[model samples]
Target: MNIDFTLEKYKTLCETISNSSYTTFTFEQYFNQENPPKNCILLRHDVDRNISNAHKMAMIEQRLNLVSTYYCRTTERVFKPEYFQEIAAMGHEIGYHYETLDKAKGDVEEAIKIFGQELNAFREFINIKTVCMHGNPFSPWLNSNIWNKYDFRDFGIIGEPYLSLDYKDVIYLTDTGRTWADKNIRVKDVIKDKDHQKNNLLIGNISTTDDIINLIKEEQYPRICLLAHPDRWHGHLIDWTGELILQNLKNIGKAGIIWYRKNKN
Candidate 1:
C-alpha cells in the first residue's frame, strides 16, 4: 500500500466530507454561530512556511464549496499579504498564526504588544476574528501561554483552538510531524487530555489521510477538528519526497527532545 500527501489525496478527503453528514465550518463561523449542526468538521490550515502551498489548499477547498479558516504567520517566508487577500477573497476566513511569545523571548508584555500590532496588520488583509498559536517546537516559550496573562477577547478575537475548544467534546487531529497519531513528536499542537484519548477507541486508529476519510465514511466521530499544515502537502513528486525526508529528520530530533524532557524530570 502506497500513501502520499498529494493534492489528489486532499481532494479525496474533501469529497469524503462532502459525502458525509458532517457540516464543514471555519473557526470564526463555528464560534460565532449560536447553534451549529451537531455533526460538523472544523477544517483549519496553519501556514507555517510555504505561502503558495497554503493558496493551493485554499483553492482546493473553495472548489469543493468548503469554507475553512487559514492562519498565516508573519514570518518573512510565510507572510504574503496578496496571498492572504486571495484566499480570503475565496470566502475563507483569514487569521493570524501568532508566535509573539517566542518572538518576544518569553516577555509577556512585549508579546502582547507585538500581538496587537500583528493582529492589526493582518486585519488590513481580512477581518480576523480568530487567532491560533504557531508552535515553535524548538523554542522554550509556548505561544499559547501569552493568554494566561492576557485575554484574546480584549483584542476582539473570538477563539483560539488550544484555549476555546474542549477536547472532551471535539476530537482533535493535527498533521504535525507529517503524520497523524504521532503525538510523541508533537510539541504544543496536541490536545491536553491523554487519558481521555487513550480511552477513546477511535483516537489512535486513524493515522493517514485515507484513515480520516474512512472515519468520515463510517461516521466515527460527530465533531472533529482537523488541523492541516499546507506546507506538508505538495503536488510535485520532488517536493513531496523532500518534505518526507526533512520531516523524518525533524521527527528524530523531536523524539530525542521528548526523551530528554521525560528523563530530566
Candidate 2:
C-alpha cells in the first residue's frame, strides 16, 4: 500500500487523474490557453522548503507526460537557479512564490520594492509568467495585499493565482496543515474573495489525501486547483515517517494560531 503523502502516493494521485477524464495543466498553461480542457485539475506545487522533493515530483509528472506549475520561494533553503532551470526544462512552469508584505513588515512601498528585486532575481533563472503568495502562518501581514497598491500586470505577470483566478469557477483544494479538509488549522492559505469562498468550502471536511483523491474520482467538481507542498511528500520510508511526525507538530501550532487569530479579531 502506498503511504499517504509519500512520493509513492503522490504518483498514485497523478495516475488517478491521468486515468480519469480530467486533464491537468500547469498554472501558466491553463491561463494562456484560450480553450481549456474540461474536468481540468490545475496541478500547483508549492516549493516551500524542499527543492529535491519538488524535482522528484517533476520527474514523476514528466514520466507520466503531465505538466504542473511549481511556485518556488526565494528562501535560503529553497532557492536554486539550477534547480529552477532543470524543473522548467521538464516543461513545467516556474512561478514566483512571493511573501513580500511580511518580509517588508507591512510597508506596502517597501514590499513592492522587495517584490521587484526578488522577482527579477528569480527571472534571471526562469521566465516567470505566474506568481503565487507564500502565506506565512506566523506573519501578521497578508502577502497578497501587495497587489492593492500596485498592479502585477505592470510587471509582466499574467496572473497571481490567489487574487487573479476566479475561485467561483475553480474549486481550490490545498493540503495545508498537512491535510486537505481542516479549515481551523489553515490560516492564510485561503480564498478571501467572498463571492466564491462559500462555494469552494462545499468540499466539506476533506481531511485526508485520500479524501481529495476520492473527491476527484466522484467527478463532482468540473475544475479544481489542487495546491500541494512538495516538502510534505517523501519516497523513502524513513523520510516519510519523519515528515509525518514533523508535520503533526506543525499542525498543532497552526491550529493554535488559527484559534488565536480568530479570537484576536
Candidate 3:
C-alpha cells in the first residue's frame, strides 16, 4: 500500500475536494454566510509545527483554487510572519491557534494577557478575524476557558471554530493521532456542542482520506469541518518517518491518558 500522510496523498485529497460538488469555505466565510450553500466543506489547518510543510500544502490548495483557514501557534518554531504572510497572500485566512491557558498554567488573567500580546503581534503582520484554541490533551486546563472571563470579539475577532461553530449542523473531522477517525486517543478535539455539552454529534464511520473522498462523492454529508494539522502531512521521508514514529508514541500516551481519565471518573 502507498504511504499516507505524505504531501502526495494530501494533493490527492485536495483534488478530490476540488472535483466534488462541495463548495469550500474558510471559517470566516462560513461565519459571514446567513444561509450556506447546499454542500459546504470548511477547510481548516492547525499549524502546530513544521510550518514549512504548511506552505507546501497551502500552495497545493492555491493551485486547486481552494481557500482554507490556517490556525497558527505563536511558539518560537511555528511563528514566522514572512512564511505565514506568503500563505495569507494566497488569499488563505490566517487564524491564531491559542493555548494561553496551558501556557499560563490556568491563570485566566495571565492567559488573557498573553493572548492579547500574541494577537497583536499577529495583527502587525496580517489581519486576524478568527481564533482557534490549541487543545493540548495532556494539559488539565482547557484553552477555551479564557473566553468565559472575556470576549474574543473584543480583539476584533469574528468566530472560533470550536466555540462558535454548531457541530450539530457541521460534522467535524480531524487528523489527530495520525488517524482520521479515533476519538479514543483524542482528548479535547471531540465533537461537542458549542455549550461544551456532551458529544451529541457523531462523525459517522469515516476514517481515511479515501473514506472522506467517498463520502463527498456520495453526498452523504451536507456540511463538514475538516481540521487537519499541517505538521502531520509531510513531503520528505526523514521528516515523514520521524513524525510517524513520534506520533505513534504520542498516540500511545494519549490513549493512556484517555484510559486514566475514564477509569478515574
| Residue-by-residue lDDT tens digits, candidate 3, 1-265 | 6788889999998998899888888888888888765588999999998788889999999999999999999988889999879999998999999999999999999999999999999999988999999999889999999999899989889899888887766767789988887558988887655532223234466568877677767867788788889989988899999999999999999999989998995
| Best TM-score among the predictions, by candidate number | 1
lDDT of 1 by residue, 102-189 (tens): 9999999999999999999888767889999998778888999999989999999999988887667687777899887655898777
TM-score of each: 0.95, 0.94, 0.94
Pairs clashing in candidate 3? Answer: none
The residue-by-residue lDDT of candidate 2 on 1-265, one tens digit each, is 6467888888888888877888888888888877655699999999999999999999999988888999999998889999999999999999999998998999999999999999999988789989999988888899998888799998999888888677878888888867777467777887867757777667787777888879888998888889889988888888888888888888788889878777996
Q: Give the TM-score of candidate 1.
A: 0.95
- TM-score between candidate 2 and the true structure: 0.94
lDDT of each: 0.86, 0.86, 0.86
lDDT of 3 at 225: 83
> Under the 3 Å rule for N, CA and C atoms, how many clashes does model 3 have?
0
- Relative to the true structure, candidate 2 has a C-alpha RMSD (angstroms) of 1.7
Which prediction has more favorable TM-score, 1 or 2?
1
RMSD of each: 1.5, 1.7, 2.2
